[model samples]
Structures are given as C-alpha cells and as structure tokens.
Target: MINETELIEQLKRGDDTAFRTIVEQWQDMVYNTILGIVQNETEAEDLAQDVFIKVFEKIGTFKGDSKFSTWLYRIATTTALDHLRSRKRKKRSGFLQSLSGSGGEEKEQIPDFHHPGVSLDNKERAAVLFKAIDELPDNQKAAYTLHKLEGLSYRDVSEVLNTSVSAVESLMSRANQNLRKQLEEYYNKHYR
Candidate 1:
C-alpha cells in the first residue's frame, strides 16, 4: 500500500497513475459529500469531476498540516457550495425574469432526491429527510451531512469545516432539532 506521503509526492510530480489512484481511493467520499449537499445525482457526478480537477490543479498548495482526506473534503465541500450558490442565483434570476413577463422559462421542479446510500425500505424516509436537510442553514447542513451521512467523526468534521468539534456538535444539535420540526410539519401536513 502506498503511504500518503508517497502518493502526495507522486501527485505533485504530475504522475497520471498517482492521480488516478488518488481519485479511485477518494472518489466515493467526494461524490457523497457533493451529493449530500447538492442532492442530485447528475450534478453530484459533474461536481465530483470538478473536485478532482481542482485537486489536480491545486495539489501543489496542499500543506501536510491535516489528513489528506480532510483536505480533500474541504475542497469538495467548497466546490459543492459554489455550485449550489450559482444555481440559486440562476433560479432567482429566472424567477425575477418570469415575474417581469420577460421571455424567461418556467422554473423546473426538482424531484425529491433519494440517496443512493439508503436502503430500499428507507428511500422514502431518506427523501423526506433530504428535503429537510436542504432547508438547513449551510453550516448545520454541512455538519450534519458530514457527520451523520458521511460517517465522519466530529474531529474530522471539524477539520473539514474548519471549526471546533464543539461547534460541530452544536451545529449537529440544531440540525437534529430542525430536522425534527421539519419532519413533524411534513407529517402533519401530508399524513394527517
């Protein structure tokens, strides 16, 4: 097994094999991180590719102060957030254009995102949960998703989020409370 130091050196030297190895090792983590935030398979796939591109381009700047995965997670998270922010801008502009009776197209409805990591019996519940997650503040969403969904430890999550573990815990607490409220409202509205 190649040590991380060796892998980093290989990557820094622009070895195609080293880059491919890194991608193979880390692709799932990257994909899941983006998917957890972006909540769309197609967009997640595209953004995962984008993450690797950025990783290759910026590999030289990676200081060894943290675990390689943590650094990669930071990159993935930032890329996903940027994609989401840009999409939000486009959506808002589209809404405004439509309201102004310009030649804007109607808004496209995003289907409930079902996580591939979920089991068949849990798909519905997961979809509902994802909707609630989508409504969370970005910090809370990142904390919850990285910890609960991606199975990162609090310390790992803190490193990825660049916050203290206690902060991650607080964000997770708020996430759970908010999720409970959102699910309760959903159930009351639809299942009553």
Candidate 2:
C-alpha cells in the first residue's frame, strides 16, 4: 500500500516485492490496453507479459514527468504495435513464398474479436466494431482505443502517444469518420 513514488523508488532499487506490487496493480490495465490493439486473447496475454518485463527492465528510464500509468500505456501500445508489424512481415513473406510455389500455407485471416469489457448482449456488435478498428492506421487506432475504449482524456492520450492534444483530436476525428464509413459498409452488406 505504499505510494507510487515509494513503490517506484523500491522498484529502481530492485526490490522484488515492489515489482510484484506494481505488476499486481497495473496488470489489468496493461492487458486491456494491449488486447484492444491486438484483439487476440493469446497474443494479448503474451504481450502483457512482455510489457511487464519491459517495465521491470526499464523502470529507471521512467522520468516521472507523466503518470506511471501513462508511461506504461506507452510501452504496452508500442509493444503491441511492434508485434502487429512483425506479424504482418511474416505474413508477407509467407505470401511471397506461396506465390513462388515454395509454400502452400493459406493466407491468415483476422478472427472476430470479442473484448472482455463488452456486455454479453453487445458482443456481436462489439466484434464488428473491433474488426473495423483493426483496419485503422496505428496512430488513429491507438488514439481511439485509449480515448474511447480506455476512457483516457485527450490530454492523457496525447501524453501516452507523445503528441499534442490537437494531434490526438485530429486522430480521433479521422478515426470516427473511418469507423462510420466502415460500419455503414458492413450494415449495407449484411442487412441490405
């Protein structure tokens, strides 16, 4: 139950108990942030573990200019984005190999994602929304996830994203437009 400053100080001194406390406190937030981006439970779990490891190793680098949670959010988003990029690269290579007739693996597809935070009655709609989210560019996706999903304020999201508040606002506006277009398309295709 120590204050965050004390906990951070203990962590910097390599106190195992403090590390455990920090993980216990922030694990859910970290996991949920990653899950919003990656949209796969298994990958989100693995990336959450990786986020904690990064926190443990990089605790000294935390400057305390922003809230600890904001720093952690930055790490989680960066890790998830990196994993997504790596996955895309692998898929591209696999596609090239298939084109060359040296590999026969089928193209990978993004599965429908159900965010745990969604209510049971909304799971179907949430899955459709998440699929559209997955199509957004990375910055827009991160801004939308942090602001809309994680309930961060525009300024806090700007801090996590290392950008200006206006930039976050711009990202959000574009995200909303894109999501509306995508959802409208889905509606037309499925219900028309």
Clashes of 2: 0
TM-score for each candidate, following the candidate numbering: 0.96, 0.96
83-177 in candidate 2: lDDT tens per residue? Answer: 98998898888899999999756777767998888999999999999999999999999999998878999999999999999999999999999
Model 2 misplaced regions, further than 4 Å: none
lDDT (CA) per prediction? 0.92, 0.93
lDDT of 1: 0.92
| Candidate 1 residue runs with Cα over 4 Å from true position | 103-107
Candidate 2's error at 19, in angstroms? Answer: 0.3
Top candidate on TM-score is 2
Question: What is residue 72's positional error in candidate 1, in angstroms?
Answer: 0.3
For candidate 2, list the clashing residue pairs, or say none. none
Candidate 1 lDDT by residue in tens digits, 34-123: 999999999999999999999999999998999889999999998988898899899898898988899666668779998988999999
